[model samples]
Target chain A: MNSVLTIDSAIVDAIVAHARRDHPDEACGVVAGAIGSDLPTRHIAMDNAARSMTFYEFDSMEHLRVWREMDDSDEEPVVIYHSHTATEAYPSRTDVSFAGEPGAHYLLVSTREPDSEEIRSFRIVDGVVTEEKVNIVDATVDA
Target chain B: MAIEVRVPTILRSYTGGSKIVEGAGDTLSGLLDDLDAKHSGLKGRLITPEGGLHRFVNIYVNDEDVRFLGALDAKLNDGDSITILPAVAGGALGFAAAAAFFGR
Candidate 1:
């Protein structure tokens, strides 16, 4: 499996925007892609069930519907992402423990600063998280 | 009734290396009991001695975290998907090297 995460610049913008919009509260979402493609195309911003600045949880019913739709479309969760409001972009112990996707990239965006946003990606397998490089490209390049 | 349970890689050893297992129970706790009966030592890893879920373990039914739903007593329905994962805590320190979890 590739260790680097390649995504479109537009998606990155959207994620950052969401994180910024939800300042003080963490934002969570997923990027669905075709099976075996490793390309994240669909950006699904999820509600932070916890709605806390320190934590995030997806609404159960929403998660079920979205997952079922992905299954029906033969798509998989290519990227599972969330934001850190005041802290840096890093997976917490809770995040690592909750990671169920060994093949999907776990992306973290930090909106700690007013003008700067930091984004990073990782692969969590068997509770072991490894940082990976994120390559942002123009959407047309991937299309 | 049969329920589909998704097991994480670290805990798959107790499930005979199977990522998915069959379980039957009306509630989340009952389902866990059923799983433990089939795969010994599995319950201890998920629940603590106090009868509550482990701090590092997370259980989700049908993609929703049981903690928000009803925790150990979360009701289970036939064909529900239950997923178990270990909580990795790290975002406390700054962003650098944040992905590398400190304590197991």
Candidate 2:
């Protein structure tokens, strides 16, 4: 049981914003950052993986964008993130089955509670998903 | 130092689909309790009655693994974050290893 972890404000904000924007269904995206201490979590895009049912799709184009951003910044892809509109904040069989040996952290956002933010983060090696406690540090991002 | 907790897609079912959650504590175990209180179903699913993590789950205080750092008792702080990940197995990509290391 590890103690605490850190995630980027932009990523967190992006996830929250998307979930709020598309309620009643799940929204998904990718995060790219250098791995080491605190791998920054940033959202690159959103999708209707299962517009009919409740599913998500991580856009490959956005992934390229984030990958390029990391490249320009001299950072490597470190994490991938997604949201569950009406599901638990934990990983599912689908997620595990599709999870490529990404060699980075896999972050998930929860939106079932609605009353309070059930946002949580975790790491998945192979198919096993491990939950990580996130400690948020507000950064200055000029809009 | 504050530990940043990373949220995954599955557990988002409990968070209303929020991607991040923050907490404070002095150990991985304590931090989980705090997190479970703040969010929901975090502790029950992650921790087992054996007083250790669910085995399928892995927690890290910073980059150091909780099992290596202090296990459930790993220390934490106001800014520290915890990541909850589960084992995803049953695939051709070393499914056994994934299940052995993670879960099926």
RMSD of each: 5.2, 16.0
Instruction: Looking at model 1 chain A, report the run of 10 residues with the lowest lDDT sum.
Output: A134-143
Q: Residue B11 of candidate 2: its Cα lDDT?
A: 68
Candidate 2, lDDT over the whole model? 0.58
- Root-mean-square deviation of Cα positions for candidate 2 versus the true structure, in angstroms: 16.0
Candidate 2: which stretches are off by over 4 Å? A1-4, A35-37, A140-143, B1-104
DockQ of each: 0.23, 0.03
Interface RMSD of each: 5.6, 11.3
| Chain B TM (all candidates) | 0.85, 0.73
Model 1 alpha-carbon miss at residue A8, Å: 1.3
lDDT of 2 by residue, A60-83 (tens): 333334444665676654556566
Quote the true-contact fraction of every model.
0.21, 0.01
Best by TM-score: 1
Off by over 4 Å in 1: A140-143, B1-20, B54-104
Please give the CA lDDT of all the candidate structures: 0.80, 0.58
Residues B51-91, candidate 1: write the lDDT tens digits.
98775666788767798878888988999988776542223
Q: Specify the poorest-scoring 10-residue window by lDDT in model 2 chain A.
A: A58-67
